[model samples]
Target chain A: MKYVLSFNLNGLPVDTLVKATDTLLDVLREKLNVVSPKRGCDNGDCGACTVLVNGEPVRACLTIGLTVAGKNVQTVEGLQQDGKLHPLQRAFHEHYAAQCGFCTPGMLIAAKALLDKNPKPTREQIVEGISGNLCRCGTYVEVVEAIQAVAAGKYKE
Target chain B: MAEYVGQPVLRYDGIGHVTARTRYVDDIQLPGMLYIKVLTSPVHKGIIRHLDTSAAERMPGVAGVITAKDVPGKNAYGLIPDQPVFTPEHIRYKGERIAAVAAVDEDTAMEALEKIKLDIEEQEPVFDPFKAMEPGAPLVRPEGNVWEFNSGKTRKIRFGDVEKGFAEADVIVEGTYTTATNDHAPMEPQVSVAYIDETDRLAIYTVSQDLYFHLGMLTAIFNLPMNKIRYIGGTVGGGFGSKNDIHCDHVAGLMALKIRKPVKYRHTRREETAYTTKRGPWTFYFKDGVKKDGRIIARYVKTVHDTGGYAGMGPYVVDKNSILVAGPYAIPNVWVDGICVFTNKPPCSSMRGFGIINGTAADQLQTARVAEAIGKDPWEVHFINAWREGDLGATQFKVEAAGLIEAMKRAAELAGIELPAHLKAMSSRGR
Candidate 1:
């Protein structure tokens, strides 16, 4: 049995049919055609399917589709506004933080969630913020640097 | 010189990555595409007594079911062509593919897989390489468990007379080193999307590190000419030598041909960790003879690599490892014997640095032991025996453009270690 799921996605209203057992990741990728949140593990062990639900970081693979019925969900696609890249995106691109780009979407979303709460995070805080994400290419140092650059106001809008 | 030399240019695909526009293999979705799930062997070693897929084919939402007989051209495909696409009767390792089902969704396909009937008689399995090499060991294949090199069972490297060099040595150091198996565990799991294009050619979107290599193997598996298939790749989400083999492309291509629709086959994270090829375990036994003057006179290394189930790239990795197991030192007499043995586990293959990293690790430990036995600084021992421009390697390969001395000096400077004036004046151009 499928249910009509309505949610605010990337500042746009999205209505799609999803099963009661469908995960937010499945609905976003298969139904709504939002391919940013990757299906890496599907077990929440990997943070590749991370997204912001109600402005908080959560693993979309673990979140049920029906649970976020009226919540505002944000993906990497939502990081851009008015044809401009977000500061995190700009910093990641400029600092070469993404190698295979498999973990970039999750890392970016997690960083966004971190900086939104703490505008000027220390190095240790930045490490703690993106600890959920894992980069197979071992780009954690560069990712921290990119997040620090964003927090230091190097990539202002 | 190019104008961009030494320039800090951004990655070409950087923008697409950050903006979530890069399309990985899993991201490519076509209409009317069916999901694929495979039936694997549950036992480590077994002989299939019975296998029936009729019940699975009759399941609801099941589009098609393919077994070993459905493989048109060939059932065997690998770097050495020893592995089977679908195990026909004999199962060598756990998670070996027996059949696959294509359905409307992954759940339906998984359910269809449960409908398939399979009967197997489990056999005694060998997990240790040393035990597998014994005379009475259960064979992993029809052939023996040991890989046969062109010369013999071992990859032999003999440069000079080791007995004569060891006779003149003052101290002998021996050590045994072992390294565990490692998984690449790339962020994105193994995935493939296969469909017959409008031109009647089989097209596949893959995350393969070696496209042409897998394309050649896929043609043999599908029994089609090279021009009959279109292999699209180059958007890999971190391979790290794990994507060199044909993981899903062959199975997905076979199912697509059977069902006449686009099929997507992907390994779950559990599947990726449990069954995919890995960096095989290595055990190295090293014995070195060094003089009190910090010069290594003789070195002998015997290494055994556990290449589980099939000869994916084990022989090649062992050969590469044997040639470099003596390290970059300028030893006069070096003898290495590299053995590749098969066990009842997942087949081990390529990883980062092939097999040299394991060999280097063992050799460095042996070098440190040599230093401690002779009451000399490890750095002094390393600098005194470092390879020079005209030095001969273990396989008699001429050393060219050697820069070990300069590299060590720079490494020491960065590491904040002060070198003595005499040691700092050493150069790689000469001794």
Candidate 2:
């Protein structure tokens, strides 16, 4: 029932034995102590458990820990380089994007996935991209506006 | 006062969300902690005649099993304390807890859930608000007429004479609209971790907005002093009011105490949607009186909300929606009434926009219809009668947040228009 799995986590290689039924969320949170990717809904319906496996955003709660072998995974911690906040992090701060911050991790990962593919997304596209991620604060107006600003290269200036 | 007020500030937490570094309750991992799972009722209405927990207690890796009988101090705990912490008599909703199993690991706790047997009878439940409000319908709660009498803190507003205003109006419009329930869909379903820290106090970590509210509830349920419960609101996952003040935090505290170890509880998506409170699903009835001259004479709105099982802020939702029936129009005569009724469905209380979204949608939609009936364009009637900064509502409250005229004008302009024909005629008549 034990499987030795080795994968790069937040830019560092992590090798551990996990049960066949162990989820990537439990592995990262309980075993490795990289606790940013939360257990929002054990099912993938809520994007709160998103982390990058091979640079593509995936719900850690849905993935089995053993499936992460040999993949270069990334997390919120990897977004910052040497104590400097990521551009998205800075933008979110400047725009008052985080009210409660629980959805921030999953939203960030999803937004990062969108930006990685298309850095210049339209306002509509920004809304569509984040439709999977729901914010209860009704901050979508600010969230969408912030994303649009970042995509249009306005915030960069 | 002249400076820009509506200028958008980049939201404060936007980047923290996108960067994936936010800490939620489940994100906290205490050393040697345990996982807890509950055996909930399969039917919406049932009584726990006998709970056989021997199989679960004998299961390997099972630390302990706690049922409602085991709960010390307060056996009944709810937003109002009418419902028990664990229902011993009847299941009010589909997911009432019967027995809870705490294990050294989450897997074992889940396994123990399969071992519990609950015997009960299903009661014919009240499924609809409209029927539940009728005279012959089965009461959803034991307080037979509490719903009809209180209407769950319904809002009622009256101004001027509605009968005279309606009779003098050139056109009348009325219609019924309904909306469905929506989940806060917070990235985090409710998660709570509790344990006795090194200080020997019952320390708890939960994702919530009002830490003080949860702390008070914990104190009452645990019979422990306020200082005994240490709450660390690590990070809130988009509450949308789901985590505003959870009814489930007590479960976490109970599990940890029963097992005598740190315990964590998190709901799956199904549980999040079916059990935890949600918003939306409101039915609205709006009646309006308007003149052919493009002036609104009177407005009447009746909002009936589905509270969905528990209180869960349903009363507040009804009041909030009823209070907003006028929208932004200038109406000299207005009457707004609301009712919040309980049903067999899952609880839905607060969501984004509180009650304003439902009220606004109904108001705007009704205004649009009234304008059409009176030979006035929707935009013109809406723009001309929109409440201004100093204009008072029927409630005698001043709107200080906005310049309603500028907003209407700019919105009309963006949509590529100035004013409707009736308003144009009004302007020429004035000149």
Candidate 3:
């Protein structure tokens, strides 16, 4: 049995058919054609499928599709606005924080969530903010620096 | 050359990564594509008594079920061509592939896998390299548990006479070091999307690190010419030597050819961690003969690599390890014996530094022990024995552009360690 899943995605209302057992990641990638949130680990162990649901970071792989009905879902695809990259995106690129880019989408989303809540995050806070994400390339130092650059207003739009 | 050498240039795919526009193998979706799930061996070592996929083929939403019999050209494929695409009769490892099922979705494919019937006669499995090397051990392969190099059973490196060097030594230090297996665990798991293109050529998007090497292997497995297949790669999400082997491409390509549709095969995290080729465990025994003046006169190293199930890259890794197991030091007499043994775990292959890192770990520890035995500073010992530009390596290769002394000086400065004036004045020109 499939249900019509309607949610606000990247500031636009989108509707798609999904099953009860389908995860938000499945619906986004398979049904809605949103391929930003990767399917690294279907479990909650890896944060590669991270997205913002109702202004909070959550693992889309663990979240059931039906639970996010009528909610605002933001992915890395949503980080761009009016043909301009987000501050986090710009900082990540300028700082060379992404390698292989597998963990970049989830890391960017987690960083966006962190900066939205705390505009002026300390180094420790930045580390804790993106702790859920894992970069197998061992780019955590550069990622933290990128987040710090954004928080320090280096990439203010 | 200097313009871009020291600059902080951004990656070419940086924008795509940040903007979520990068397409990985898993992100690719084609019309009427099916998902793949494989049936693996349950026991570590076993002989397949029975295997039936008819029930799985009859399952609802199951598009196709493929077994060892479905392989058209050849079932064996690897660097050494020892591993089978699908285990036909004998199963050497626990997670060896037996069959695969393609269906409408992952759930359906997984459910269809449960329908397949399989029976195996279990056998006693050996996990330790030492135990496996013992006489009358359960054989992992028909030949034996040890990989035979061109010379003999071990990768041998003999330099100056070790007996005379050890005879002149004032102290002898011995230590044993062991390193556990490691998984690459790339952020993106092993995945492949295979489909027959409109040009009638088999197309596959893989996460392979060595695309051409795998392409050659895939051609042999698929029984097709080189131009008959289109191997698309690059944009890999962190390989770290893990993607050097054909993990999912051959299986997905086989299923696509059998089903005549686009098939996507992706390993779950558990599968990637448990079954994929690993760094292979290493056990090293080091014996160093040192003088009271902190000079390492003689070094003897015997290393055993536990290459599980198959000879993926174990022989090459042992050869590379044996050549440099004596470390960067200018030891006069060095003898290294690197042995590659087989166990009943997942086949171990390549990792970050191949096998040099493992050898270096043991060598560094032995160096520290040599320093302690002679009552000398480790740094002084290192500087005294550092390789010069014209020094002969263990394999008699002339060292060129040696920079160990300069590198150590810079490292000490960065690490906030002050070197004595005499030690600081040492140069690699004459060692």
Interface RMSD of predicted model 2: 3.1
| Docking outcome class, model 3 | high
| lDDT of candidate 2 over A63-138, digit per residue (tens) | 9998889998887878888887766666666666667676666667777788988999887788887887756556
Give a tens-digit lDDT track for model 1, residues B1-431. 59789989999999999999999999999999999999999999999999999999999899999999999998998888999999999999999999999999999999999999999999999999999999999999778999999979999999898888889999989999999999999999999999999999999999999999898899999999999999999999989889988899999999999888999999999999998999999999998889999999999999999999988888899989999999999999999999999999999999998899999999889899999999988899999999999899989889999999999999999999999998999999997
Distance from true location, Cα of B359 in model 2, Å:
1.7
TM-score per candidate, chains pooled: 0.99, 0.86, 0.99
- Give the range of the ten consecutive residues with the poorest summed lDDT in model 2 chain A: A148-157
Predicted complexes: DockQ each:
0.89, 0.55, 0.89
Candidate 2 per-residue lDDT, tens place, B295-364, comes to 8888888888888777767777777776777787668898888877887777666777767798788777
| Residues B183-296 of candidate 3: C-alpha lDDT, one tens digit per residue | 999999999999999998999999999999999999989999999999999979889998999899999999999888999999999999989999999999999888898899
Q: State the TM-score of candidate 2 restricted to chain B.
A: 0.90
| Total clashing pairs in model 3 | 0
- Which ten residues in a row are the worst by lDDT in model 3 chain B? B72-81
Q: Which ten residues in a row have the lowest lDDT in candidate 2 chain B?
A: B422-431
Q: Alpha carbon lDDT of residue A156, candidate 1?
A: 89
Comparing 1 with 2 on TM-score, the higher-scoring candidate is: 1
